[model samples]
Target: MLFVAGSTVLGGASARAAEQADETSTAESSPIIVTASPLPVRLDELAAPVLRLDREDIEASQASTLGALLADQPGLSESSFAAGASRPIIRGMDNNRVRVQENGIGAGGVSALSEDHGVPIDPLSATSVEVVRGPATLRYGSEAIGGVVNVLNDRIPSARPSGGYSVSGGTSFDTVDQGKEAHGALNVATGNIVWHADGFRRETSDYDTPQGEQFNSWTDTSGVSGGGSVLFGNGYAGANVVHYDSEYGIPAPEDPADPVHIDMRQTKVQLRGAFAFDSWLRGIDFAGGYGDYRHDEITQSGVVGSTFKNKEWEGRAEFQHGAVGPFAGAFGVQYRDRDLSAAGEGGELLAPNTTRAVAGFLYEEMSLTDALSLQMAGRVEHVKVEGTALDTATITEYDVSRDFTPLSASAGLVWNLDGGWVTSATFQAAQRAPEAPELFSKGPHEATETFEIGDASLNEETAYSAELSARREGRGYSFAASLFHVSFDDFIYKALTGETCDDDYASCTDAGGTGTELDQVRYAQQDARFYGFELEGKVALLRTDTATYGVTGQADYVRAKLDGGTNVPRIPPMRIGAGVYLEADRFMAKAGFLHAFRQNKLGPNETETGEYTDVSMAFRYTLPEQMTGGASVKISVVGQNLLDADIRNHVSFKKNDVLLPGRNFRLVASVDF
Candidate 1:
């Protein structure tokens, strides 16, 4: 039997809905810039659901990592592997299914391979973020079968400066780990040329948890970016270079006395261009990037135990066209190449690998009537994977190559109702080829503390997903809600074989345990089902000449199970929250309570997690120009887990040993000139 709750207004395009006015309001429901879709239409014009986190919300959150900043949002959860390493889990799907990209390019990091690794992209580097679901995945690729989290970086200038020159900077501090960060950006536009530069540095000490302290959870990171663009009469072209470095530690439950840490570096170069024409073809846009990344895992003795490296490049081109015979659409092509390798201890897990892929996608929309539209899209990808396949049976490695052609398609319907109300339904059938790690891994991984194994005979994974959502954009009251379900065939996942093993694979099944510290897990496939719903909205309770008071609330739930009546491991439990806010000219504040219910649904060898409530607060004030030498300045105070709750992330691999950070007070001050 299946269970689903009923709600009339549970989900919608929140980005297109009303602003809460927590830190003041948007320019009266300003149109959001949408990028996930092939067409440059408003949120309502797209069939899938989109949730955006704007600049104001980032300032209020004052979170350093991308996962920490967006974890509390509806339909989203974090792995919370450590204070420094965390990744978002969308509707119980994570890792390979979710694509975390910067300006349409992959992060080019190894974070997706393991939860203990950090996503190199920082929250401070992005001006906004979009969490897109449903048909939007067709535009990215098969890897985005779950969804796409697109980070809009400020490294490249999209528009000219306000007054020929502009500068902005900010500094933040938090008490949880005594974290401190400073960031600055400068943009100058003269004539048709625009230049941009930005840099940031962040450092944190081991964070305090409800239980004394998390011994090895701290992070030190810095990055710098510079770019320039030449504006044409109809479009613009730009290029940017970014360099990043970071060192972070994870929980050491396996070896608490001698914790392991990682040091990583990445350099990326990107080029983007857009052209508008006066023909049936409306415009052409292009994006390309090259990234060289590497990381070293160091033991407590300060010796590098393993090294991972990746050099990759990707490029995409899009062609937009106007209506033709009652239909309008866009078509595009994309190409990606990656070369990755592991050495030292990591070499036992996987050998050198290379992957190349090319895909072509197109989407078309037809207006059935004035208030209704039909959208359809399709994509076909050709992928070639080359690597050394490990034969667990023969205890030998052999070079192997495989090729696959995965296809995907989607269809959606949008209905426009009266009074700023809109609803949409989208369905997609997508397939994903086996990633390098899934098909070639073997041996013990000290970072995750798992003796992993893989099979080279794995096939493509496929899923059929659907979403239904509605939204209302209003000043006094607004709301959005969504219901989604995804069914998978041949779902590839890592599961323990109810056994333990040592560092050597031969001992894994020898009836005796050598390194009993490591759990034995293998890559396998199974039929699975997932379904979830999300609800979020805000309503004005009181309105006065000086300020407006509003009440806000949100709730989300997801459930997944295998065909054999077994629960899915690491699935987030139901969460419900509510809050109140005040918005004025110079002052704004919000207080909220978010609670996670107890989770009892257990997978094999999985433990239960207790319930917890998080009390949070945010306040912001704008200073007068006279006080800051004509520079616009804003100060914000943000608090998280104010009640100091003892919380464990159900989605985390280390949930049994690690606790979420306790009470935290964050202060942010930014200035613009």
Candidate 2:
């Protein structure tokens, strides 16, 4: 369910209604930006399933990792490997299949390289977040065949406030991890120029679970950004710079004595511009970014075991054209270049390589009638990868190079039925080129605790997906549901060989000794199929000017298997959730229960996970007007796993050793100025 704030009860309100409320409350309310499109569109008008989380939602979720924050949402789950890092698993697909972005540009980092590496963006400072679930790959890229998560921030001022200056700050504390966080942001306008600045700091101790404290799960993060923009007639130009640093520990090393923590830092710069013209062309939008990121893994003895670096740059330009014969569309071009390197005592160059790519895309929407719409989109990209590797025993140099031209296309239709109901159907054909790591990796990786091996001969992965969805929004209730299926021609994934290896491959080849005792995994390709469905609905039980009450129900399930009949490893289990909520002019409260069913289907060397339920609640109140600042002030208390349930995520590699946080409470306070 979407969020509602202030005054009259908005129980069971849809996202469209919530957005309308914001506009009524604030004249300058911003619309949800479509990073993949030339211009922004209303959430309700889109054919695909799109989830938008604003500042309030971010504050309410306050999870240690991005995946954890969205895990409860329909068709989403977290690969809860550690408190330090977790990546979102969408429709049972993750890693290279899902794309993470910041303000429409790729987040240039090694987060996708391993589950232990965190995404560089900080949610605490984000203004909003958006998720696109179907056919977005037509515009974003084939890497996003599963989905796309875009984090949006106002580091580069886009608009001036009613007043000359605006400032806001907040603080929050979480009990489970003994975590403290503080953040502040400001925007100042002087004529046509606007300046923006923001900063945040967060620190946490080891988190406690129902069993006990999860040792070495602490984390520290801090960052700051500054930017400015100039607004001219019908256009704006802006640039921003940011620096982020973080430290966190990994608790999955086989030997408790082994060192396993990461110290990471990144510096990024971006520029954006848009212009409107009074000609056949409607508008033009452009964006570019450059990032320098690196991380060092430290052992318990203070030794730098491995260091990884990523230097990347990307740019995009799009042109919007006026409708021609009932067809409205935009065309664009994109370019990206990246270099990855690693070095250290334990560092074996998993993929010391350089990747370069350029692409062009076209998107169009047609109004078949006042109640019907059609959308078509397509993209073609040319990519090249070059890498170098050395044999462990022979010490021989090997050069690897691969090139491919991938194409993606999608078509969708939205029908507005009677009774305030709408339905959509989408079909897409997408292809993904092999990533750098999948093509050149050849050594032991500490993050995943495996003797890594890549297949340079792997073929491109091709997928055909289809989705059908329906939604209804009425005066006091809302409902939405979707069903999707995808078939892959050659899915590239790591498969366990059921063979044990020492710290290095040498142990496995030894004549008389067992190696360090780690599983050996090899990159392989196989035909696969995945299908899923998500259903959600809310109903109002009572409504009045002073108070309103509502109930919500949601369920999601996914099944994935190789063509040979073996289940996919680490797939999310079926989940169902229900909740109750109440809201008034100054107060709001909600409680919910979610249950994940036991997963019995297993792949080779995989274990089953038991079922579990999580209970959560939260209450918020608006303070009285005498708070000094000419803005609203609010306080909130939130609780998760109120029943202290022992929870284990099957999708996590460390599920056997680590449990999720338990019985945690958070105190949150914030003000708008």
Candidate 3:
């Protein structure tokens, strides 16, 4: 059975009839909804490729960060320099080019400003996650030109439970880091009223590597959320509140004698509503949120060295429409306002700034034939930033204001061929304004150990891209492949200036820098291009009445370069992997081997990374029923990097100074009541 929101395509007529019945009965028995999209569209019908991580997937991975959760996916890699802080690199693009969201709303954090800052969302508390690479740029913003990662927690009660109440809980432990995690969720409904509550906590010691333990690699995370809603005849409305807090160490090279840590906290409130209609418009959906986030960098002496804060409010509204002469789609409006500031020792890196943005978008899909369809989306936005910059040395202050109008559009065509084969082609053009850090930063960043300078004259970056994908799904075999290329005009990047500076911005004359050996870097613009290919397939080897076995293989590679012949920095190496799996009524197991090819294509002042391979295995077993509603307890064991080989992520800035985690093992258990 193929399960998707709005539409479910099953293998047989009986299966189709069963799905229809479930859709009308309870949401738990129905297909998962695609909340990331403006209009409710089936996953398979989407013009662009999407990667989804369900609750089961998240539980099995035992990932500590969003970057680690997606690092293994094709065309994706983790910054991986530090265990406590890392961001996803999509299709060779990272930083501001990628957008992180919680339930389709901006994270309202400063993770994009620097590599050491961690994303505030807690993956352990999420119900599902969705990744989109193309069309998301139109609906969300130009920052999604690289991709979008939407974490769906369902904090706001969207629907009522079939019964009076439902409860779920899980716990896990990892050997590599001596880590422990636990989470629980509850949902109760009475008549037209529904309520929800969830909480999660995680703690870990410094992780162990093949050589020894990585210093300052510990993490502590916790979060709680509560919400309630009223179900009206027309639709449902709800509001939610969430609190998240985390404190983690920032591992440093052997050179640094003192240790660093980050203390962070966030409080967020969200309101959502949806209404069904009987007119040309199908329904209206709206969501709005406000967030207050703050973080402090602590030194070994127990003093707070630097502090950062972000206060933001964001909202979106969209109206779904029925088919009208082969046209069906949704139009929406979005607004966001953020005030960001920094203080203390490292405050000079970025001036306090406030940004405001307003946008309108339209998306439409037309069915040209039984097997052919076209999708197009466009967005226009106005953005403004206000700040004040002061020259401390000269005791002079200056007013800073910048404004931009960014536009983005995308078109795609999907053709359903015979024999369950499908193909899609997409082209997109997107523009993104320079972020505050890229436009105004003027001092040292202690976390990244870099002396940074920004360019106020930088213009908005623009990208044009095209992609072609093909897939064939069968009963015993399946395969997918895609090729993509992108060209950028005025790509903004940090370039090394071949100058070194101490923490006080004083010239460092010693070869072995004592205070801080940080190179000076300046934001610059250049014409660049990136291209990649990804392929994945699975084939069944044996099948029986109650058991089946299969083999899977996947490979992906990306290349990037500038127009003037310099290679892009920190590009992920090419990777190929294979795995085998067996499934039965009560047990399931899988094993895999992954190889990362050596990367010799070096950027200016960059070093090459050696190749490495990893071995991983996992298995799960369902015990006898122990709860109501056919809910059975399940236990899972997972192993990663079983080889214990030394590994380095080519995309990581600290690859040469630090090694990736060694062999790891995890035991997880979950139950529903």
Candidate 4:
């Protein structure tokens, strides 16, 4: 059954409604800025759903990773191996399907391949985070079919002498782990030349859990970044470079018989430059970047391995001219090349792979009328993959090559109505090619206790999605609701056929042949569908000289089907949450509770996960007098599984054996200068 529910309000209608609700309300309203264009545009004018996490919001959340912070936002989910490893899921899609962008460019690292790996960029360093919930096909490549999460930092050398330094030291109660970090950035300007430099180092000890104490786990990370620019008559040109390294791992239990242990390390380097033109081709911009990354992992199964290297190069050019009526457009081309090689023990090459992609796109935003606008975009990408397949039997390999061409497009309309109401509707068609691991993996997945498999004949997956939203903004109260549906063909999934090896373990075998049992894993394609609704709003309750307070509420429900069947694995359940925030000029506090609905409907091969709830609180304040040039202190307390609920994330692969973190507490403190 296809379900669609929601009422659409015209653009600017919410603002009118809010004005009608209150005449004395002084709530400041502003449009969100998005990097989806060569030139930024206001979110309300972009004709898509874009969530902006401003600097104040980031400081208030006190999250450790970008994935963790984004999880609580609408249309986002999180999958975590531990506190140190968490990946973000967007609209029921994850892994390579979602693109993580840094200042409109790719992160160019191993984060796209594995779940346990962390994003190399630091979340605290970002000035803001933007989550583009609609098709970003015009700005990014085919991989961004799901959406784009851009982390913007101060990478560009500022032409002003302004910068700050921060130092923080804290400890975790639940993990009994202590950590310290320091970061400093300086920007100097002289005549037409600007120089900037920043560096940071962070270290942490092993962590402990309520179940027991985990050992051998520690984290050490250090990085330095610098850039310089020269202002000229035509434009400003700049060059930037960054080098980073980190070593971290998950420890085994103290029982000494545990077989699960992971030790991982990574190092990355990037160089980039950009230029803007003023003469001849006015409003034209160009930029290019190069990146190299290396990773190594050591497991307890004697499968010591290392990935030697992967390099990426990308270039883009765009033109923008707004004086041409209410119609503005930008078009550009991008190219990326990635090469990777891996080796096991004895310095033996497991498999070597290389991929190249080229794409071109155009985006146009037109103001159809005074209150109505339209956004149209389209992109085409050509990707080629080539590599040498390892033949374990004869110790010989054969060459493999494949190419794919996919096209994506999107259209959206925004209507501005009176009475503080705003409405938008969007339709998008996108496709994604298979990732490297999905096409070539052949080994044991010790973590899941299963033999892994892959097929080189896999094809691209395609999807079509549509969404409608309505929002009303008011001084005393506000509300917004959205309904969305997405359908996919050739959706890739892992299936279990109720077959096992004689060794009493899961294994794949030739059922029609001589009954020879091998590994127990294969990637298959299936038709899939997802539909859901999300609603969120806030209300200002009280205002006074000493204190101001507000209430916020949000709810989400999603359902997915595979091959027209009711069973779909790894789907999150309906959730509802509410919170209150109180603040003074220099002090602020927040408390909230989250409830997750039970998931009883399971696929023939699915497991059931019970329902649960949790509560959390935080507080922050500024010092009376300046200890240094500038000073502030922040403290927060978070209690996971506050109800002591024996709950597990329904979407987790480890749901059968592991439980979410039990009742635990975490406290944090930081200072800025």
Off by over 4 Å in 3: 1-30, 253-256, 388-397, 504-516, 626-629
Worst 10 residues of 4 by lDDT: 1-10
Q: How do the residues 55-165 of candidate 1 rate in per-residue lDDT, one tens digit apiece?
A: 567666646677777788888888888766788788889999999888777888888888877887887787777787766668788888888887876566655666666
Instruction: State every prediction's TM-score relative to the real structure.
Output: 0.94, 0.94, 0.93, 0.83
Scored by lDDT, model 4 comes in at: 0.60
RMSD of each: 4.8, 4.0, 4.2, 7.1
Q: What C-alpha lDDT, on a 0 to 100 scale, does residue 194 get in candidate 1?
A: 78
Q: Between 3 and 4, whose TM-score is larger?
A: 3
Per-residue C-alpha lDDT of model 2 across residues 1-673, encoded as one tens digit per residue: 1221111111111112223222212212355354534444544456785766677777877576678767778888888777768888899999889888887788899888778888888788687666776544566777899988878787866566556677777899999999999888888877878788899999999889999998888899999999988766666678999998889888657657874889999999999766667767877777899999999988778888789999999998878788788987778899999999888633564647899999999888888999888888899999998986545456455888889999999998888899888899999899999998887776677766877667777788998999999988787788889999999999988787776666555565432337656677778899999998998888889999899899888899999999899888888999998989998998989888889999988878988889999888889998877765467788998888889998999998888888888898889898877
Clashing pairs in 3: none
| Candidate 3 global CA lDDT score | 0.79
CA shift at 621, candidate 2, in angstroms?
0.9
The per-candidate count of clashes, in order, stands at 7, 4, 0, 16
Which candidate has the top score in lDDT? Answer: 1
